[model samples]
Structure formats: C-alpha cells, structure tokens
Target: MKIKSYLLIILIVISAVGLSVCSYIYTPAKYQEYSVGVDKEPVMAPMLKGASAGVFPWSPVEKQEDPQSLAKKDKVAETKPEAKIEVVEPKSFTKVDDSYFDDAVFIGDSRMVGLSQYCPEIDSRATFFAKKSLTIYNLQKDAWIDVENGPKETIFDALSKISFSKVYIMVGINEIGRGTNEGYRDAYADVIKRILEIQPDALIFINSTMHVTKEKSDGDELYNNGNINVRNAALFDLIDNQHIFYLNVNDMLDDGEGNLDESLSGDGVHLKGSCYEPWHQYLLFNGVVD
Candidate 1:
C-alpha cells in the first residue's frame, strides 16, 4: 500500500510538470509582446482554443502599414496645381485703301481746309472739321469750325455731338508760334484725350506738319524746320505704334531735304491743287488697317 501511494504521488507531479511546459510554450503574453514591438494600427486577434480551456486569453494586435503606401499619400498631400494666365495681341497694318476713310473724320487748321478745297473729290469720302489757322487754344472758341449760313458752334461742342471710326488730326502750325515744344505737346495731348473720350474706337492718324519751302524756312526762324520738327517729335511720342499712327504725308510732298517742294506750292505754305493728288495717293497706300 505505501509503494502504491508513492507511485501515484510521482505520477501526479510528472503530469503537473508536462502541463506547465505546454502552457509556457503557447502563452498569450508572447503574442502580445510581438504585436506591441511592431509599428502599425491596432486590431483584435482571432479567438484561440486555449482561451476556452482557460490556459490563456487572446486580445488586440497592432498591424504594420506598408511604407510605400504611406510615402505615396504624403507626396500627394504636398503637391499643388498651377495657375493659368491670359495673353492679349495688338493690331497692326502695312497698307490699306481710300474706302478705309469712308467713316473717317479730319480735324485741323488751314492745311486741312486746303485739303477740302484742292481735292474736293477725295475729301468727299470723309467729313472735314477744319478752319483757317486753327489752333488748340482757339478750337473751343465760338465759330471756329462753322457751316454755310448756319449758327456757328465751338469745335468741342460740334465734336461732342458726332462720332467717327477713324479720326485724322493735323493742327500745330499755328500753335508752334506761341508755346514751347513741351507746352505744345501738353495742349495737343489734352485735345487727344478729349477726342478719345468722345470717339473711343476711332483709329487716329496724326499727320506730320508739312515742311515749308526751303526759301520760306530760311526767311523765318519760328516758321522753320527747327520748330516744325520739334512739334512733330511731340506728336510722334503720342503714338503707341499700335493704336495711334504718325503719318508723314511730307514724304510725298517734301523735297527730300526736309523742305516742301517749291513747285508744289504757290505761297511756299499751301500745296497747289495739282500736288494734292500725290498726297492723296500716299494716304491710300499707308493708311492703317487690322
């Protein structure tokens, strides 16, 4: 009986040792430590049979995210879309014709008046707003640009009532007698601003002041090329080389040495009827268009 009792006791001890070894090999603590060491989002682990046996309990384990996926997401967050910009193009013209002036208007001094008288047929295509010896200062005065047996109106008042697509201006010969080149330009610029205000879309052609006969320029200092060129330079600056144009009609009528051809003029100042044809032809070839 004593030997049998000893054997049973040894058998119970061996059984206890085997159960401890199995529990240590498959513990919940081991799996928990492995999940904690990884860098990732956490998730619940699947139930195990050992939990039903009361040997161990399973819980949540952290899952590691792919490095490449994280990197791609970060790159997308940093990128931005670019802004779009708009560009505008300016108009230019190398040549045109007389029909181009059908809706045009001319405003100026005696030279412009002479244009209507010498070339009435050509002048008929465009309306003339001109007078003898017209200056910027006197343009707004009453009765500057008048009509036949009708109530006279100021140039500004008359211009306010009308509009034109093309506005040609040549009125500085009288103005040169009074002010400096800068002063003349300021007055001219003011005139241009008002004209633009009234006729916003008009294609402006600022004709160069015609040079005098060589003998006439030699006779008077103020009426010479020295003063005329100075005034014309002011007009040139007003042109943007796009919207406004500086037409040198003198190219057709000038003697090539900065002097008006003596034969073209009877008074060394005004061009004769015969010479106006070339001036009209020059306008036909050089007029602006888009």
Candidate 2:
C-alpha cells in the first residue's frame, strides 16, 4: 500500500511538469510573435498600456505616432530659415567750389538771367539758357533763348546741342498765376525728365523760387511768398537727394518772417544787383561734389 501511494505522487508531479512545458512551448500567436530567440534566453514581450506588469518586466513599449503627425514634425524640422531684407537711405549733399560750375548750365526765368549777368564769377564759368519772361510751361515748346551769334532756339534744342556736368533750374515764379499747382508741378516734372534724358550724367539742382518782399506779398495775392512756397513744396518732392537736389536760396535772402528782405531788392520782385553776390556765394557753398 505504501509503494502504490509513492507511485501516485510521482505520477502527479510528472504530469504537472509536462503540462507547464507544453503551455510555454505552444504560446498564443500574439505572444509567439514577440518570442523570437527564446531558446537562448527569455525574450521580453512588448509592454502595452493596461497590460499586466507581471507579463513583461524588461522595458516599456514605445508609443506609436500617427503617420501624418510624424510627417508634419519632419517637415517642420527640415524647413529653411527666412532670408533677411536690406534697407537703403537717401544720399546727403556736400560743399563744392567754383570749378564745380565750370561745366555747369543754368536754366530758368528772369531771376536766372539776373544770376547769369550779376554773378560775374558764375557767369564766366557756367552756361545760361535764361530770359526775362521764360516759363517752364513753354520752355520745351517755344524758342525762348537767343543763341549767341545764332537765331533764337528752344531750351530743349540748346540743351540737346551741349554737354554739361551740372544743371541748375529755378522757374516757378512765372508759372504761379497761369495754371493749377498740379499742372505747374507736372510741367516742371516733365521738363526735369526731359533734361535727364538729354543729360543723364548731370547732377540736377532744383533751386527754390525766391520769396517776394513783405510789401509785394501784402499787395499782390497771386505773386506772394505763400504761393511761391506752395510751388516750392511741389518742386521739393521731385528731389531724390542723390542725382537730384533742392536748394532753397531763401534761407540766406529771407527776412525772419519768410519774405525777401526789403533791403535786398530794388523792385519788390527782383533782387538788387549787389544781392546777387550773396546768391552766388549760397550756390558755391551748397554745391554737391558728385
């Protein structure tokens, strides 16, 4: 009876061991997928969220990402940086000398005529295409200039015939009462454009119309300093400060009240012959080197 009891115990132990071996060998398809190379050592199963911790004890499962999200992240990482932009400022003016006007041309109305005649140093150095009643409105169209030893010719024709390094222009005074400020500015701009086409390399100086005397401005509404200022403001818009410039001679000639000094002019409109010396000096001091 004792031998039989021992044999039954041995059989039970062997059956338990055999069942454990079969359970491990015939693993489920899910477990078997991760059971590669299990003979060498126990292979760790992929850990998943809410999975039993007792099942896989080696490492945590890597979180899977959406293909679109992964692609977007890769795109962001590979993107190129934006390019930088550059800014440029307008050019500034510098002083020059008498030799600067050696190849220069002066173009305008009576004031420019006065400049050519009275400013003897400048008159000798620069060429002048000026007349008593010359208007920018007719400068390109009418024959206004008397070529020395030649017939009268349009300013445009004269400009086309000669080569000049610098061009000085001041002619809004005659145009004040004839047309709208817009029309005057457009005509003036057209003349500037034409001059540029003729002398592309020349440095252009747009001299502001000289202000009238306080007595003249108070008496005449059309030819007043206020009207001159409005026209000068329009001309100021055309300067680029590089190849083109705006020189306001009124700085030197005006009284504290913005009118031409009463002492500087014999007539209310025209400067005295003696005053032209200071005007020439203003031009000399305010010249651009290039």
Candidate 2: tens digits of C-alpha lDDT, residues 237-264: 7888878899999998999999999999
Clashes of 2: 0
TM-scores of all models?
Answer: 0.67, 0.71
lDDT of 1 by residue, 1-290 (tens): 99999999999988766644544444444343433321342222211234553434343434555799888888887785556676546455566667777888888888888888887655878889888888867753446667568877776677777778888888878876796777777777777777778878878888999888999999997788778888899777888756578888888998869899999999988888677887787778877676
Lowest lDDT 10-mer window, candidate 2? 42-51
Write down the lDDT of every candidate, Cα atoms only. 0.74, 0.80
Off by over 4 Å in 1: 1-90, 140-143, 147-150
How accurate locally is residue 18 in candidate 1, as Cα lDDT from 0 to 100?
A: 61
